[model samples]
Target: MDTDVIICGAGAAGLTLAVDLARRHIRFLLIDKAAGPFAGSRGKGIQPRSQEVFEDLGVIDAIVASGGEYPVQRHYTEDGTTVDEPVVVRSEPTAAEPYRIPLLVPQFLTERRLRERLTELGHIPRYGRELTGFAQDADGVTAEIAGPGGEQTVRARYLIGADGGSSTVRKALGIGFPGRTLGVRAVVADVLAEGVTADAWHRWGDGTAAQVSLCPLYGTEMFQLQGPLPFDVEVDLSAAGLTALVRERTGRDDLAIHAVSWASAFEMNARLADTYRQGRVFLAGDAAHCHPPTGGQGLNTGVQDAYNLGWKLAGVLGGAPDALLDSYEAERRPIAEDVLGLSTRLLEAARNRDHRRGREVGQLDLGYPDSPLSLASPGHDKGVRPGDRAPDAPVTGAGGLPTRLFTLFRGPHWTLLGHGVDRASAPAPRTGLRVHTIGARGDILDPGSHVRDGYGLASGRWVLVRPDGYVAAVLDTAGLPAAEAFLDSVGVRPPL
Candidate 1:
């Protein structure tokens, strides 16, 4: 095969997958038909769970530096103005929940950062190379990619469709994308603004009328504006059209929109693919599911999808069984279904002029407890279980150095954490996995007992953490053999 994976589309989903695959030293081709990076403030809200994913991928610092917390919304009317709290709930950072709030950054900028990280990993996304068609057989997939040079065929072990809602790969695979589309349209764009508060989001109009809102993007001077598109009329997105809408909605003739960076008239849609996999090929991100942009779940969910699939692919390629790949769909598809329902409900609330949101938008609780990959001791279920997100906790290392559980779990390798285990008698390192002992006499010192308390390890046990930061299995005894059995079930056979 020419490559191990062929990823179509270079949006948040595809680029994220590319970055993760690159970290694993996987030979893959990342392609997109777009001439350059996506130029839009399309999906701006990155949830906390995705932030954890970024931390693991070695990009969280850049992500945090590039964005800020979602600002409070300021409502406006002709007579007066009222300041409303943020639609997305925010919380203080704790030992268990470090990233407690969502961060706001433009979608294009997010992709660029991921691309830069991929380049650091020794791979550059192949822009201008488009996947036109393909066919998958019993062994692998044969993809025909069209580029500036010419059309050529490339073979790969797997083909992933991160190609957005109107996915060419999904169509070729003949998988059904079943969902409902909204007829209402909105004129969305980015603009250079004046006379608006940069500290908060400004908006006007009731849900029944023409609604318009302008939010100052975190890292740039641009403000993303959303206005209702006129029904039964050819929508005008020119400067004049925008100026007219601005005046009519905000009632601010002094407010100036100097330039229109990017604009689109979009019709809302909520859908999910019937299946995420078909033999040798798979679908992810918007290709596998599309949700209304109400709760900012679209982009965040896509990133999580990529994170979940990347390690599974790396493990399978390293020697794990192909059956392990099946867990990707099992774990992520249900999350997509839940996210679809959420964003759709949020969309309804928006129509009803109610913008209340809960902790669900954080996506921190998303897990796959029912997935085959999630295993646990039949009698041991006191704290976090298999398929639960492994929480973060502060711990001290050698020489009183400060560290975190998330820090140890950050990388493309499974972490087998032993609590109260003997380092002198601990098992040796195995291929595709790392062994870490957490205790005072162990490799890591749990100074404040955070690891013991935060992880709920009242007694001693072996907790296996997946690369994606989810608990794979928790065992009370049977050290290496039990762990090996769990790994074997997932197609990962470490050299004994």
Candidate 2:
């Protein structure tokens, strides 16, 4: 095979998967037909769960620096007066959930950060290269890629479609994408406004029907302008056309849209592929599922799909079983199904003028409890369980240095945490897994009972966390063998 994997589309999903594969030393190719990075502010809300994923990938600092909290929405009328309303209810940080709220960085900035990270890891995406078609046999996949010069044939062990909703890889495979197109039509654009303040998200109308909103994007001077499009009107994506539309909708001739950067007219859609995989090709991100942009779930969900699949792909490439690869669809397809329902409901709520977003939009509670990789212990089912997000807690490392559970879990390896167990009783460290004991006289100390109480380890217990930061198994000290068995089931192989 020419490469281990061939990833089509260099958006959030493809870039994220490329960064992961580079760090794992996995042979892969990342390609995109676009001439450069995406230049839109379409998906700006990075939820808490996605923030944690970025932290694990060593890019949280850049993401946070480029974004800020979601600002309060300020309603406007024809008079240019405003009334402030909190669109998202913010939450305080706790021991278990450190990132309680979402960040508001533009999608272009997020892609730039991921690209920089990939460059740091000695890899870059091949731009202006499109995957024309591909054919897969029992052995591998043969893909035809088209570039400016000419078309070239390449072979890879697997092909992944991280492309957008109109995915060439998915369509070529004849995978069924079954869903409904919402009646709503809207225009989303990035523009520079002369009169709008950057502190609040400015909006007009009754908060729903026939309204226009301008949200100041973090770390940039551009504001994202969005409003409904009339069915009879011919759509115009030009700067002058968008400016006139904004001026007409807000009824504010004083507010001038001086420049427009990127614009698109999109009809809301809620779609999920019938299957995520067929033979050696797999679909992820918008290819596998496309959600309405109501709950800010589209880009974040794609990032997570890449995170969940990256480790498994690396493990399988390192001589693990094919079952590990099979678990990708088994675990992620259901998530897409559920998320489709969620985003659709949120879209309905928006149409009803219920703009208040709550904790459910963060997507922190999403997990694969029914996954074949999850192993449950019937006796210990109080706090964290198999297929639950492993909570974070403050702990002390050697020489009384402050640390966090997230810090330990940030890497390309499985984490086996032993709570209330001594160092001697901790599970032996394996080649692809790291073992750490937290308690009195253990390798790490949980000074304030934070880990003990937060993790529900009233007595001694072992929690095996996957590379993706979800609990794989929860067992007693004697259940180390079972934990190992669960790892075997997922084909956890030694690192290169």
Candidate 3:
């Protein structure tokens, strides 16, 4: 095989997966048709979950330093009535360390960070290389690509399509993208508008026809505008037209539209692939799911997809069973479907002029509520909830090193967390599990309660957290032997 994996499309998903695979010492190639990284901020808000994934990738600090945080998000009526007070929800860190809130970095900056990380890992994305076609068999996949130089063939054990909504690989595999497209059209423009403060996401509309959102972008007093335009209207975003829209919408006729950084006309749609995998080929990101950007979930969902698939792909590449790969589709497809549903509903709510309802629905942290990956205990309901990304909380060790509990999950091990338990009674080390004893008093729980109360962690109990920060299994310390056996059955042996 030319490489273990051939990832088509060097967008957020593809680049993130490539970086992860590189970290795992897996051989992979990331190809894109674009000459280089696309410029300008497109998908701007990285959600809390996506921020956790960036921390895992060791890039969140740089992202935060480069981007600003938008803490206060408010919902308002079209007539400027405050529907809800600004809610300040702190984005805690995950099971990983260095807790920080989600940053408002443009998609371009995100791509740049991933690209730099990939380069540092000694695997630069192959630019101007487009996947033309591919064929997969029982052993592996062989893809044909048309590059700037010429056509080339790449053989790999696995092929992943991250090439956006119009994914050629998915089409070649005969996967159907089923979803609905909105009849109304929207024009998204990122521009520098003076006088608009960079504090919150300003949304205005009633339930039905037109809604507008003005969100801050990093530097340059820039903001991204998204709303409905006339179906018959052609989106010619000349400087004058953009300034007129700003003045008309915000009632600031003196506002100057400096640079129309990026402008595009898009029809919102909610779609998901019938299947995420076919034999040795797999699909992720926009290739597998497409949804309206109501909750700023487009890029966030794609990055999360990469996070979920990365370690699993790494495990399989490291000689684990192929069944592990099946879990990717099982776990992520539902999340995508849920996101699509929520985003569609949010768009509808915006159309109906129900800004409060829309914001409430959009702010919901929808997670895997039904997955067995959660701790199956009766009273424990905090920390990382099922179907939701784990939240980070600060913890101090006996040595006084102020470490984030998530730091214990740095490597590719299934972390076994023992809250309020004595270190002497910790679970025995196995092949793929890392055991840590976290305090119930200071570290494991959020403020306002004991760690045990925060995460519902009982003394001498084991909480199995997946590499991606999802709760994989929870067990009483007495069931440690059984848990070890289960881990073995899943091919995840705790480190010895």
RMSD of each: 1.6, 1.7, 4.2
Local distance difference test values of all predictions, in order: 0.85, 0.87, 0.73
Q: CA lDDT of 149 in candidate 2? A: 82
- Compute the lDDT for candidate 2: 0.87
lDDT of 3 by residue, 1-496 (tens): 2989999888899988998888888899888888977776777767666766777888877777667766354565556566444333454443432334445788888888888888888989889998888888888988888988799988999999999999988999899999888776888888877655677776655443445667787743678877777777776687678777756765556566777888888887888999999999889999999988665778888888888888888887766788878888888888888788877876776576543332222322646657544445544454555455444556666566666656777756677778667667765667767777765432343333333554566666667778887776656677667667657656675453
Question: Which candidate, 1 or 2, would have the higher lDDT against the true structure?
Answer: 2
| Candidate number of the best lDDT | 2
TM-score of model 2 (CA atoms): 0.96
Candidate 2 residue-wise lDDT, 1-496, digit = tens:
3998999999999999998888889999999999988999999999999999999888989999998998998887667677887778888989889998988999999999999999999989999999988999987899999998899899999999999999998899889999998988899999988778999988787545668889999999999998888766788777778778777777767788878899898888899999988988888899989998988999999999999889988887776787788888998888888888888898888777667789998888999888888886767858877888999999899678999999999899899888777668765556778888776667788888888877788567888899999988888888877887667666663334
**lDDT measured at residue 424 in model 3 versus the true structure, 0 to 100:** 72
Give candidate 3 regions above 4 Å deviation: 71-102, 194-214, 244-253, 354-365, 372-391, 419-428, 438-450, 494-496
Give the distance in Å from residue 461's predicted Cα in candidate 2 to where it truly belongs: 1.3
**Per-residue lDDT of candidate 1, residues 1-496 (tens digit):** 3999999989999989999999889989999888888999989988889999998888888888887988888877668857677767667989988988888898878888898898899988788988888988988899999899999899999999999999999999889998888766787898887788888888788575578888988888899998667666787677677887888776679877778999998888889999999998989999999887888999999999999999888888877788889999999999999999999888888888776567899999999899888775655657778888998989887667888999888888888888887665545556777788887677788877777777777556878888899998877655556767777766555576
